[model samples]
Target: MPAVPGRLRAVCLAAAVAAVLTGCSSSDDGSGTGSGTGSGEPSVAETPRMTLTAGTELPLDAYERSEDDVYALAKAQNVLTEQCMKRYGLAYDAPDPSPPAHIRPNARIFGLVDAGEAARYGYGSVARTGPAPTKPKSAVLGETAKSVLFGPKTKKSGKALAEMPMSQTAAEKKKSGLVVNGSPVPVGGCLRESYLKLYAPTSSSVDIMYVFNLKGEAESRALSDSRVKKATKAWSACMKKAGYVTAAPASAARDLGFSGEAATGPGAVTAAKADVACKAEVNYAGIRFAVQSAYEKRSADRNAETLGLLREQAQDRLRLASQLTS
Candidate 1:
């Protein structure tokens, strides 16, 4: 999908450590309570603990866009980009912004949380759990359209553009001198222009990726946290008892040598089931979630001023998106 610069990059960075660590830095679990079950030892819940399923939002969710909102923003941006292209006498159709219904955004953020999903798909996707995906829009762009949608095709300019941040890229695009049919291509092309129109809008715009970057930082810290280490070690032992030899949940899929059809085969299903079972027994997800939350809370506290501005900007961006799409 054609996206604003940094959106997918930030998401990719966050997902890179998806199975390893994920969390918010706050102590509150969004429940009115001020604490969570982060203790190193496992304890029986007096009542049923809410299963940390794909639909469960982490504490950091407050600072980020929801999956539906993401799709809405992308669709709105597509409309704006197409309009911009029309002004330059170019045709542009951005890819569909719809996401799969069954697969929630946080599906694998904790990695293989659902035993039922594991039993059916193993390490494979939960595609079978959802409706057939919508056919994507054709994204073929003529060389002219490409240059206009993006920027100049010169190797030197391409190299420079690739390294520059979006803000700088937008500034440079003004003097790019790459005119199309007597019209100057907006900075970074129509794609970038549409992004700026909704997300940036001004030179002082707070980076949309700021909260995402902070979450990534928290995840990194949570990975090394003592509480997390203890819980994971217990999980590893639990896995070992179940005849799996993985040292950590993150490495379990890789350690079990399986590929292609074998990945979702009986053996894969068995191992995945064991992995999820061990995680539950050791309370791995809850512990890690808590640890990451604490880290994120500290990060958010330190950056409160910037985060406040970013939050306002994000809401305004959504309002503008609604206006554009409406």
Candidate 2:
């Protein structure tokens, strides 16, 4: 729910050697936003209320960064990190950042909406149902390069270097007191330094996760709203009529025992197609999306001041990222 699901958190920390990039990486919310590297889409807050569709931009979107923004920021970070590694006489070429394919950003937020997708991959995402992508070959790092790229292991604690606390500022890097290749390894090495440069430039920088937390809260509220519940019940009845018994669309895949490889089987595909049809018949997605948007509007209003600050910080980062990448 926190934009960056637990599964993608490792990708965020894997600053070095991200060879096979996909659609959404860090801060992915199963939902997509609009263009530009700035805050987000125009204020849907003032617009007249209308029936919402799958992948429709919500009001809180103004405070959120789009997937394009996340990728641009990541590429800039990679460029900066590679440049830092060059300073230490190590050759490093960071791969472009991307999210997994077939994930139509919020397409499945309430349940599958695309009939074609349901027929092909069933409950599984394209990334999971299709063949794995080939990983690009990267240069192997020697001990010296590894030590400089990722800080050396602690002597006393025997802690994994990757698990070490990372410094988010230059001052913190300096205080870490780590030296590699006749130079200071910024707290958690060049990766952490690149992160600090792009994300947390100052000690007082607001956390990037702040907006996502608010979005998640609103989504949670929308789930329990009476209108959404009513729609879900109608969808359930429709699915039952189609010979697929399930309590809710959200749990259909699990209830049907579809997991991993089984999700892509013919049986799953048939059920998935039926599931999507039922959702459409009952207007489930429209109802849930509308209710969720209303909740997001309320949350945005309550946190307007903080959201404004976060938006400004995001814009600043995007500007700097452009310069760094260019």
What lDDT tens digits, residue by residue, belong to model 2 across residues 151-249?
666778755444444236544635345565687765567787788778777866777788788878878876776555666777777778888889987
> What ranges in model 2 sit over 4 Å off?
1-54, 99-105, 126-136, 155-174
Per-residue CA lDDT of candidate 1, range 108-165, in tens? 7767878888999998777745455688877888888987788665676453243323
lDDT of each: 0.65, 0.64
What is the alpha-carbon RMSD of candidate 1 to the true structure? 8.9
Clashing pairs in 2: 22-98, 22-99, 23-99, 23-100, 24-99, 30-105, 30-106
